[model samples]
Target chain A: MSDAPGVLTHAAVMTGRSLRISRRNLDAMITAMMLPIMLMLIFVYFFGGAIETGTAYDSYVMYVVPGVLLLCAGFGSATTAVAVSEDMKGGIIDRLRSLDVGGAPVLAGHVVASTVRNLVSTTLVFGVALLIGFRPAASLGGWLAVAGVLLAYIVALSWISAAIGLLARTPEAAGGFTFFMSFLPYPSSAFVPVDSMPGWLHGFADHQPITPAIEALRGLLLAQPVGNAPWIALAWAAGILAVAIGLSGVLFRIRTA
Target chain B: MPETMIEAHGLTKSYGKPSDPVRVLDGLGLQVPRGEVFALLGPNGAGKTTTVRILATLTTADSGTARVAGFDVVADRHRVRRAISLTGQFAAVDATQTGEENLRMTARLTGLSRSHAKHRAAELLERFGLTEAARRQVRTYSGGMRRRLDLAAGLVGSPEPGVFFLDEPTTGLDPRSRRELWQVVRDLADGGATVLLTTQYLEEADRLADHIAVLNGGRAVAEGSPETLKARFPGHRLDLVLTGREAYLRLAARAVHHSPGTLTLGLPTDGTAAHARALLDEIDPHRTDVERFSVHSASLDDVFLALTGETAEEAAGETTGETTEPTEEPTHV
Candidate 1:
C-alpha cells in the first residue's frame, strides 16, 4: 500500500499533529461549520419556499448541495492561510526551517490537514443540508462520485490557500484571501441559476470556474446529463492545483535557497 | 578535519525587501570542533542569525561553502539537516498543543514509530520537567518552560549524537534559569554533541563556549577563546590617584595627561598586574594615599566593543548601532 515507510511515517506523524491542532481548535472548526449550516438553513426553510424555480423548492436545496460542498473546498485554503500565517508571525516556521525535517513534508502536512478539515466541515454541511431537505436521486455509487469531485476541489483549493498563506506576511492577510474565495461561488452558479443572473453578469457567471464546477457537481448528484462542463471543471480545478503546487514549490525552494 | 561538526569557509549573505538588497553576512568563516560549544558574538545585525541559518540550510549563502557534520549545506542539505537540530531564540512552541502533544508531533514528523513517538514524548516530558504541564496548552506555559519544551521537541526522534545550533539560547532568562540552562548546555556538550550558538550576553559565552567569534560589519573581526581576545584588548587600564597636586602632575605626566583638577591618573597597561607593580614602584605608596588603583583590563565587552567598534551596552536601547545580534536573547537549551 505504501512505497516508503519514511514518507508514510512522516505523514502519519504530521496527521496526528494536524488532528490534535484541529481538535483543540474545536471552537474555530465549529464556527467555520456554522457558516455553511446557517446558509443551508436560511436557504432551505425561508428562501427555499419563496424562490421560484421550474424545479421543485425542495429540489433547489439538493441542487445547491454540491455547490455548497465546493464552497467547503475554499476552507482548505482558508485554514492553511490562517495557521501558516500565524506560525510565521510567531516564528514557528523559522524554527521549522532550522530543523532537519523536509520543508515539503512539513508543508504537505499542512495541506493534508487542510483537506481533512474541509472534508469534515463539508460532511457536517452535508448532514445539515440533508436534514433541511436535500435528497439525491442518484445511487450510492453516484454519491461517492459526488464526494470524489468535492475532494478534488478541496485538495486543489487547499494548495491555493497554502500559496496565499506563504505569500502573505500576516495571518489576517492570509485569512482575507478566503473571503474572496468564498464570494467567488455566490456570483457564479452556486446559490442561484446562471440564467436568472443579469445579461452581463450571466456571461461572467456562466464562464467563471465555480460555475462549471457547480454544473459538474449538479449533474453528478441529480442524475442530470453529464456533459463537457465536468471535463471543463476538472480541467480548471487541475490547472489551479498545478499552479498552486508549482508556486508553493517555487516559494519553498526560494526560502531554502 | 578533526570531525568538523560545523565548517564554514567564506560564507556570505544579503537580505532586504525584494526591491532593496542589503548585505548581512559577508565572507564569514568559522569552524566548530566536535563536541564543543562555539559561541558567535556580535551587536544587533552582525549577521549571527544569518550565519546560523546558512549553516542550518534554512538559507543559502551568497558565496562560499558550509558543512554541518561533514555534509555540504548546499549539495548535501538533507543529510546536513538529518545530522543537526536547531532551537531558535524564541520558544516557537505551538500554543494550541500541549507540551506532550508538541513533542509527539515533532517525533512523528521526524519518523519515530507511533508507539515510539508516544514513548519519546513521555520521556522528554519528564526529562524537561514538563510532565506536570504535559496536558496544559503551551500558551499557558511560562517562558522557561516553553523554551524547555521547544528543546525537547527538537530532541524527539534525534536519538543520535547531533550538532545543536542555538541562537542566543538565554537572553531573557532569570539568574536561576540561566544557570540551569548553562548546566543543560554543559551536559549536551559532555554527551558528545557539538553546539554552535550566538549571544549578546558575553558572560554566558564566557562560561559556556569553548571558542568565541565576534562579528562586526558582516565579518569575523575576532575569533578565539574568550580569554585570548580579552588579553589582546586594553586588558589593564589602571587608575592612579595621588595625595598632592605636585605628585599628581608628576605621575599624570607619565599617564594620559588630564586637567590639573583631575586626581585620578589614567594608566594604560597590558592587563598584566606587573604594570601595577611597576607604576607603584615609581610612586611611593607611603607618600601618596592611592584612592583608586583599580585595574580595567580587556573584558568580553571590551573585545565586543573594540572589534565591532560599537559598545555592546548600546545594543539594548536602540536598534541603530549594527544589525548583528544585539537584543533580547532568551534561549534556554
Candidate 2:
C-alpha cells in the first residue's frame, strides 16, 4: 500500500531471514564449524612431523592455523551459494520481486550472513589451534590487521558465491560451486608452502589471490614483516568484490527477467 | 482508483532462442475493471501464467503495453508492484520459517513497522485459520495450510484495495481446499479488490469470476460472462444410451459425439420437448434400439469444446507435450 520499504530496511529483513535459516539448519552449521577444526588437527598431528614448512615455528599448529582459517572462510561461504540458489529455485524470488524488493538487498543479505558465519567458524578454529600449543607473537595492532584482511576476503568470497548461486539453475548445481571454492586454497599456499610444490604449479601458486591472503594472515599473526602483502590482499579482495557484485546484479536480472 | 484496474494491449512474449523462439503470448489483450473478478481459464501452457507474470511485474512482455492500477507495468514497475499482490503457482513461504514468521517477514518487507508487523502477522494468521499452526515450521504444513499462508503473506500491508493476481491458485488443492480458496477470492472481490485469477477448472470460473476469458494457444478464444459464453452453444444436449453397438454405430454419423466405450450418443437439441421427441423418433421410432435419452442444459465445458474444437483435457495434453511448463500437479506436501 505504502511505498515498499527502503533498500536498507529490505536488506535488514532479508538478513534476518537468512540468519534464521542458517540457525535452523543445524547439521550444516555444525559441519561448517567442525570441518576446519578437523582439518587443522589432521594437518598438525598426522602430517606435521613428516612435512616441513621451511620456516622456524614453535609447533606445526602455528604454521597450519592460518591456512585452516582461510579454509574455514571458504567452507562457510559456500553455503551462501546454496542459500541464494534455493531462493532462486523456489517461488520466494518472484514473491519478493513482486513486493518491490530489488536484487541488491537480497544478495546483500546473503553476503552479510555468510560473513558472519565464516567469522564464527574462524574464531572457533583459532580457539582450537590455541589449545593445541599454537602461539602467536602478534600485538593488538597485528590482530586487528589480520581481522581486517580476513573480513575483506570473506566479504569478497561471499559475493562471488552469491553470483554463482544466481548463475546456477538448480540448488544441487549451485552446490557444486562449494567444491571449487573449498579447493581454491589447495593450489595456493594454504596447506604447504607454494615453493615446496613442483616447478610446473608454481605459476598458479605464486600468482593466485589466495596466496597473498594467506601470506598476509600468516605474517600478521606471527608479527613478521608483512612487506606489502596486506595491501595486495586488500586490493585483490576489493577487485573481486567489485566484479562479483556487478556480476550478481546482472545475473539476478537475467534469471528473474 | 482507476476504473480499469488492469489493462493490456497487443502483449507478446516468447522463450528459447530468437531463431527458434517458442511464443507463449501472442498479442494477448485484456481489461479488468475495478473490483471485478476476471478469470483466465485455460489448459497448461495456454500463457495464463505468462500474462499474470507480466502484469505482476515479475517478468516483461516481449512486445506490448500493460498497465496495472493505472501505472505502466514496465516504466513504473515500482509503483505497480506497490499496488499489486501476486500469489504464484507455488506457495512462496519459507519452508524453514514458522507461518507467523513468514507473515511478519513479509509485513516488514512491505514497509510495516516492527510492532505493526507483529500485530498484522497475528491478525492474518487468525484470519486464515493458521493460528494453531503459527509456531510450526511451514515445511510441516499440509498443502492446504501452506496455500492459505501464502495468500496471507500476499495480503500483508495491503491496507488499501489493490489488484490481486492468482496464477493457478487451486491447481493442486483438494476439493474442500479449493472451495475454501474460492470463498476467500469471492470475499476479496466483495471487499472491493480487483481480482484476476487463472485456472484450468471451468467450474471455478463459472462460480467466482464476473467475466471469463477462455485461453488457448496464447490467445483468448472466447470472452464473456459465464451465461453469455454458455449461451453461445445456443441449445441443450440430448444424451442417448444405445442397447447395442449396432445402434450406436448406426447413429454415430448423425450424433454430435459418439462414445464407443459407453455406447452413448450426444445429439444437439433445441431444448424443446418436440425436438427431443423428433430426434428420438427419427433415430429409433419404435424405441427398439435406443435404451433411454435425457436432455440437459449446456455447461461451460460444452462452450469450451465448441470454441476450441477439443476437450480441455485433450488440449491440455497437447500443450504439455510441447511446452516446458509442468502439466502434472506439483506435490508440495
Candidate 3:
C-alpha cells in the first residue's frame, strides 16, 4: 500500500483525469478540430484547382488528405504542450509530485491524452476530406496500416510537444512554440511535392521526417508503388518517440527537482 | 517527548542562475513531534514554502538532510510522500474538474480501489462541507470553498500516521473561513496526526500552533511555545484614549508616547492590578480626561517584532508581492 501505484494503473487514472478536462474544455476542443478542417477547406477550394498534380483536382484530393491528416495530428499534439505548461504552472503538478503516485504518471497522462485527442482530430480531418470528394484506393488492411502509422506519428509528436510545454515559462510561450512547429510540414511533401521546391529546400524536404511519413501515407492510400518509405517512416517515428520520451523525462526531473 | 514525525538539519536551497543566485533557504533546521500543530512563521522570501517543499519531497535541498516519518527526504522520497499530504500555497485542485472529480482522482492516484476511491471522494466532500457543490465545477467555487476542497483533496487517501504539510493554507481566507480551517487543523492534531503549517500572521500562529518557529532570512530566529515566546517579551502595557484632539495634544506634551490619529497614549507597566490603578490615579483627570483605558499583556505580534524586526502586517505585504496570485489578492489577515 505504501508503494507507488503500478505505472499503467496510475497512468490510466491520470489519463482519465486529463480526458475529463478535455471533455469539459469546449474552447480547446474547438480550437483543435477547427484549425485543420479550415486548412483542408482553404487548401482544397482555393489551391486545389491551381495546384499541379499528375491527375485532376479529384485525384489531387487523395494526395493532400494524407498531408492534411499529418498536419492535423501535428496541430492537435501541440495542445498537449499547452496543457502540460498549464499543469506545471498550476499547483496540481506540485501536489501530484508530492503524492506517492510519482512523476511518470503525469507525463504518461499527457502523452496518452494527447494521442487520443490527435486520433479524434485526425479522424475529423479525414472525414472532412472524404466529404470534399477525396477517396482512398487502399484495401482494408492498408487503411489499418495507415491508422497504425498515424498513431505512431501522433504519439511521437505529442511527447515532443509535452517537452516544449514543460520547458516553456508560460502558456503563451508553449502555444507560440507549437504554432511554429505546425509550419514544419510546409517545406515537405505535405502541401506540395518535395521535387517542386528549389534544390536546397528540396534536399531538406526529402530528408526530413514529415516527407517520408507523407510519402508512406500517400503510397498506401493511392495504391502507388509501396517502397522503402513505410519502413523509413516507421524508423523516423520510433526515433522521434525515443528522443521525445528521454528529453521530456529529463525536463520533468529538472522541473520537479 | 513524542516521536518526531519530521526532522531537518542544515537544509539549504537557492534559485536562479548560479552566477547570480538567490538563496531561499540557508542552514534551516526543524523538528516536529507527531500530533503537534507546529507553525513555521516567516515573511515573504523567508523560505517557508521552500522548507515545506523540501520536507514534502517536492523539491530537493542543496545541502543537509530532512526526514519525514523516519524516512530520509532525499533517499527515500517516495516513502516520505506516502506518509504525508501537502496543501500548497496555491489551490491545487483542477479548475475544470468538479470538486468530487478532483478528490476521486487523487484517491485513485494514491492507489485506492475504484470503489474505495469513490467512497473516499464522497466522504471527503461531506466532511469539507462541499457535498452540495461536489458535482459543480471547481471554477465556480468561492475562494474559501476552493481552499477547503484543496485541503480535502490532500486528505483523499487518508494515509496512516498522517503527516500534513500546509503552506499558508489560510492566507486569503476571510475571518470566518480562517477560523473554520483552524478548527479543522486542530481536529487533525487531535486525531493524532502531525501538522506543520506555514503562515505570516501572528494571530494565526497564536490560535492554531502548539509550537511556533520564527523564520527570518531563511533561518530559524526563535522557536518555542506561543506562551513562552510571549514570556520572553515580559510585562504589560497601559493604554489610554483621550477625550478630544485638544486633550490628545495636551497629553502628547506630558506623555512619553502619544498618537494624534488614534488619540491614545501607551506606557509600559509591571502587569499588576495595583500598578494599573496607581498609574491611572497618577494621571490628572481634568487636563486630559480619560475617555477609556485598558491593560494588556505582551502578544506573539510583539514577540515577532522583537525577534524578526518586522511587524506582521509588513510580513504579509511582502508575501503579496512575491506570490504568483491565482486570483484577486485576498484581503490581508
Q: lDDT of each model, Cα atoms only?
A: 0.74, 0.87, 0.82
- Candidate 2, residues B5-113: lDDT per residue as tens digits? 9999999999999999999999999999999999999878899999999999988999999999999999999889888888999889999999999999999999999
lDDT: worst 10-residue window of model 2 chain B: B322-331
Q: Rank the candidates by TM-score, best first.
A: 2, 3, 1
Q: Choose the strongest candidate by TM-score.
A: 2
Positional deviation of residue B61's Cα in model 2 after best superposition, in angstroms:
1.3
Model 3: per-residue Cα lDDT at residue A24? 86
Alpha carbon lDDT at B206, candidate 3: 81
Can you tell me which runs of candidate 1 are displaced by over 4 Å? A1-5, A44-50, A55-63, A87-91, A94-99, B17-20, B233-302, B308-333
Against the true structure, what is model 1's DockQ? 0.39
**Count of backbone clashes, every candidate in sequence:** 19, 0, 0
B259: Cα error in model 2, Å: 5.0
Q: Which of the numbered candidates is closest to the native, going by highest DockQ?
A: 2
Model 3 chain A: which ten-residue window has the lowest total lDDT? A53-62
Candidate 2 C-alpha lDDT tens digits along A94-189:
999999889999999999988988888888888888899888999899999999999999999999999999999988898886788888888888
